[model samples]
Target chain A: MTEKTAITPATHTVPPAKFSHGVRKGDILQVAGQVGFLPAVEGQAPTVAGPTLREQTLQTLANVASVLQEGGASWDDVMMIRVYLTDTDHFAEMNEIYNAYFEEQGLKEAPAARTTVYVGLPKGLLVEIDALAVLG
Target chain B: MTEKTAITPATHTVPPAKFSHGVRKGDILQVAGQVGFLPAVEGQAPTVAGPTLREQTLQTLANVASVLQEGGASWDDVMMIRVYLTDTDHFAEMNEIYNAYFEEQGLKEAPAARTTVYVGLPKGLLVEIDALAVLG
Candidate 1:
């Protein structure tokens, strides 16, 4: 059996609870849901990137990518992604941002399958995104 | 590079969108979000198991397991599970049902990491779940 390892980027603070920010076992990496919080600052409460969905969505995607990097993967390795939005109306805008971001990244592999749904998150958090990546 | 294949079980109807029920590439399989719809009957709409949380929760889990089976993986191979609950109050009860169900399955490997949050599912649905499994 392949050993399981927990992954936390060097720049990230310890997750609030027991869970790792990402886990890698075998060739698979699962990134925990990441929100729009800006880069961590010790002794400072995590802050949302901004008030708009565009700002938060971009930060959320960047955060997801960072965890993937910590696992020795990248957006190109992702097979699936799930997005949780607090407001149903934000779906279109989220997709707009998501598409533009991925297009710019130009993933070399087939784009990941994705699912989006409405969900409530803690205050100031507009989006939470997670990913599953398979490294060859 | 391993080829990516979309998986749709024989018992399932074509997904309403351009997505697969599950997708497998190399050693990894990603199952899309699944709700508590009962087994399918050709020419009929998908139906929920019942109106209660337990009924729906169990069915939702069975739905996830079926997809894993389709992809040649099982709950024992799962690396992560994300659950979206329609009601905040359902968290505790859902966990109770979830623990009992997994206990009965008796997964032989490390239990998959899990995250749960409140969401607004379609009418009459109380939960949605998706899984990521890695096969040796």
Candidate 2:
């Protein structure tokens, strides 16, 4: 009986919140909620931050992908994702970029089962994403 | 090759106002952010909803447990849990009740690799809980 190993990122800003970045229990990798967190540029306040919401979101997912790579996995290993958007109006825009990422990754089968919702986010950020990847 | 599964509670309220009560994939159960949700008492708002934060927290965990049971599992199968509190100051009070629950459940080891954080929650709710459980 192997237990899931919890993975906490060394980059202080990767999580950008109280939660840990990812936890690997057995064959499962659970990525915590991520928002527009750019580790190198996270210090800049959103007000002063130049990256658009879409840009930041991509950057954050990139960071998550970086972690997955470190753990010997890829985006195709991801089986489920939960996206929280501060504005549902941006769902199309977010999906546009989201689909592009998957397409670029060559995930032709069922994209991960997803749940998207509009919510009030802290730090007034535009979006937050969390995921579950199976490495079994 | 296996596809992950999502779990919905049969007895609990559907589509919680703030977040999903819980989600399950395969043998792993990933509960969404849950705060002071009282299915027993109807129409109770997050503010002043629970008689106490401890009570509310317990109710929220109970809800999570119910969903696990509905999926043919139990609390003993829980692998990880992340708890968010509006105020970290309540750690002591919450811990008392939290410890009591685990003890009652005969949890010999720790109560799942756990993380607790203080954060701003919706509806002024004091606490919210999310969890992951794996059936061996």
TM-score of chain A of each: 0.95, 0.80
Q: List the global CA lDDT of all models.
A: 0.83, 0.65
Give Cα distance to truth, residue B132, candidate 2, Å. 2.8
Q: Tell me the TM-score of chain B in each candidate.
A: 0.95, 0.81
DockQ (Cα-based) for each candidate: 0.25, 0.14
Question: Against the true structure, what is each candidate's TM-score?
Answer: 0.63, 0.60
Q: Which residue runs of candidate 1 sit more than 4 Å off their true CA positions?
A: A1-3, B6-21, B34-118, B122-136
- Over A8-33, each residue of candidate 1 has an lDDT whose tens digit, in order, gives 87766568899998999978899999
Clashing pairs in 1: none
Off by over 4 Å in 2: A12-19, A40-51, A106-110, B1-55, B58-130
